[model samples]
Target: MTDWQVHALKYADRNSRTRAESFIFDDNHDAPHAMDYFIWVLRRGAEVILVDCGYDSEEATRRGRPILRDPRDALAGIGLKAEDITQLIVTHLHYDHAGGLHLFPNATIHLQEAEMAYATGPCMCHDTLKMPFTADHVCEAVKRVFQGRCVFHDGDAEVSEGVTVHCLGGHSRGLQAVRVRTEAGWLCLASDATHFYENVFENKPFPIVVDLQNMLDGFARLHELASDRSLIIPGHDPLVTTLFPQDGPEFCWRLDRGPSGDFNL
Candidate 1:
């Protein structure tokens, strides 16, 4: 069985459109750009797991996000479709991370139960909490539960042979990151738990975080779990392609191999 295969299913990128200071550190005047969201396909034998669904282009435009490419197009390049997806791990219920849920019909979704509550609960009124999510998407996930496709977990849990999910409540309640053992080595998808590598390296929590303490704690936990810090990939870091190898043409991306020992700067 091949270990793990990941693709950059980017739905959007910050291409000189909007300046977001919220994603950067307090001391730095630099603009830290980001990729919206996409699926991480982990395959060992016939089992396949998808981490996060990229949002639709229309909504992204409505929100004034710069659309780089369509996520579905990225999936097609890998010969996959929504129904072909076996399982999905939602890092959080923010629209960018979970909006395309309508695309995957046959996959059982793994999500933090606390995340579901927070997205739908009254806590969204707080400025720090409400800005990152879309209530409509949370409502859809709730509906999927009745359809027997949602698997809710409170904390850490194993979804398959090599994938582990750690529920970290900070960027959003129930937001989790995935750690997978691959032939290359251990890879941890920081998801939205930490938007950029600088957020972890500098201990700076992204501005939209709900619980500041949880966000900081989550960063520490990521460090503890990484086989090597380099394998820990941030959710929105623009430098991911440069840090790792390129698989195709100038724009395409690829995953790299390493141990759980050191962080890749």
Candidate 2:
């Protein structure tokens, strides 16, 4: 099988009071939680593919989330220059995930066809549905489509030899997860499909969901696609950084290698 090195580059984090019920549907437990924001890089020899373009400082301030560092700068810490990135997978067009697309001047963005429609169509007319997205970010993606830099996928598609994007729209109309063949095994990057390991392992749906049934089904899909439960990486969990081996003092974690710790779940 073709193999690639995967790295999770964390750019910012926030501490907030979250009701457990909000994360796990129908269960109530108010408490504090830490949410981390990250962008992933998959490298196979000379080829590089980025998962998401994290939000900038302005976005952080606008959203009331703290900015640790610019995502482009964070990518640099992992030896990747934003301008050189030619391929990117946008999981969704939410402000936090798609806000920094302009940084990659020469990149072909891969997105789910449903996602583009959801972001630009009538669904966004609802305040609840539109709250998670930034119009400017969605517009940027539209511009990319016009520029011939956007590749829309209807469902599961191979991005390269060992990397595939699975369209599992639950969190958003076109949210997708990346499955990568790595030295450790197939690592499924569950970007927002599950924000934390508990969300999947416990079958708990995150509160902000477009389709509850699909969100529940997505958990099962993630398990089916990953090599094992341990190889599945949740999108915003701080435990990911703790479980995987860090690349150095930097915020990047090496995902191609087996995790440093045993899977707690």
Candidate 3:
């Protein structure tokens, strides 16, 4: 397998959120639970594959989540421009995940078939089910579909020789996780499949869930995909940057090098 280097680039943050918003049944719900936004990049020479582009400024305002840096601007930290990305893996259609679909106009999007349907289908009629999604983002994806720029997967499929996406519908109807082969071992980017290490390791599910059972099953699935517990990078955990060695510019962590210190996953 071709070895790839992975970097988790932080772009935005939400510090006011509490544990109740993150975990479904935690006793310490009042405790502060911060979430950091990031867009992951996998590279091997000039080839660049992006995973979940961060939300644009519009989404930040509408959702009350401010951006520390624009997702497009954050790309410069890794010497990449929006036009340079040729492949994108969209974990789900949530506002934070697919909100910048239009930003990567040059890339072919990789998404689960179920995710597209969930975002556009009847399920979105309910406000609770639709809260995390933005209509414009879904429209952008639909436009991409018409433009023949999307590769839809049924469940688990390979995006590249060393990179793959697996459907783990729970947080969102079609939320999936990205797995990549790196020098350190197999590293899995658990995007919303496990928002924090505790969400999986402690058997807690994030509050915004579509299917409770699928969310529960996905925790185990995340562990199964990675070589070690420490290698599993959670989606919104602020600890991810500290867990892995910092690389390139600020807010960027080199996931391919593994953890810099014992995170005690």
Cα RMSD for predicted model 3: 0.8
* Order of candidate numbers by lDDT, starting with the best: 3, 2, 1
**Which run of 10 residues does model 2 get worst, by summed lDDT?**
19-28
Please write out the lDDT profile of model 2 over residues 35-140, one tens digit for every residue.
8999999998889999999999888889888779898899889778999899999999998899999888898999999999999999988999999999888889
lDDT of 1 at 75: 68
Error of 1 at 18 (Å): 8.0
Candidate 1 local lDDT, 24-141, one digit each (tens): 3465446544444445666565666788987777767668875566666666666667678868999999888887787777878999999988987889877667776777677779
| Candidate 3 clash pair list | none
In model 2, how large is the Cα lDDT of residue 4?
A: 95
Whole-model alpha-carbon lDDT for candidate 1: 0.75
RMSD of each: 2.9, 1.3, 0.8
lDDT of each: 0.75, 0.90, 0.92
Query: Which candidate comes out best when scored by lDDT?
Result: 3
Candidate 1 residue-pair clash tally: 9
TM-score for each model? 0.89, 0.97, 0.98
